[model samples]
Target: MYRANEPIDGGQNQNAATVPGVVARPRAIRDHLTPILDDLNPGIVAPEIQAAHFELKPVMFNMLNSIGQFGGSPHEDARQHIHAFLEVCDSFRQQGAHEDVLKLKLFPYSLRD
Candidate 1:
């Protein structure tokens, strides 16, 4: 009943669904990741990309919750919002906005560890 862009925890009708958010939870994502991963752009494959992508889900959820409540920075609560924003940018690539994709691809790294 929810579109991918719509906030899952937004204050419409909380009781209507036990599950919430852009992507579903661990169980559902785990079960479906293989096929979905197969279909996705291959560059997404980092060592812990899936976990990095979804494990911080509480960040996105909390962002939605906070934004719906009042004026705020959804990002202030969690750095995961950075990744969430990245996901949104990537999604927009299908519509031909490639500079962000290129920038994401070309991010510089520090040699120091």
Candidate 2:
């Protein structure tokens, strides 16, 4: 369609948007947190201060194992996985493409390949 003084309608007259190069999206835990802890080391600087040293990792072993063990408690594992998965999705939605959030909901676990 065209007006008296207007040009004829042509959908091909428009230019397409330029897309940027393939980008590596920032991962919250891997990119940000790991850099901070990359050079970190655990050591006691004060031996005379009478400070209590407890290994938190080994201490939580029983509780952590009880969550995912077969016939132990499947509910806890599901909750933890759901929470972790949603946290990653939320992080992506905040910084990365929101469309990627849809893919986050689909974790590939159905095949060994």
lDDT (tens digit, per residue) of candidate 1 on 61-102: 444444332223554533454454445334332233333443
For model 1, the superposed segments whose C-alpha errors exceed 4 Å read: 1-75, 94-97, 101-113
How large an RMSD does model 2 have?
Answer: 19.5
Q: Model 2, range 81-106, lDDT digits (tens) per residue? A: 55554453343322232434333323
lDDT of 2 at 86: 46
Q: Give each model a TM-score.
A: 0.20, 0.22
Give the poorly placed runs of model 2, Cα more than 4 Å off. 1-76, 94-105, 109-113
RMSD of 1: 20.4
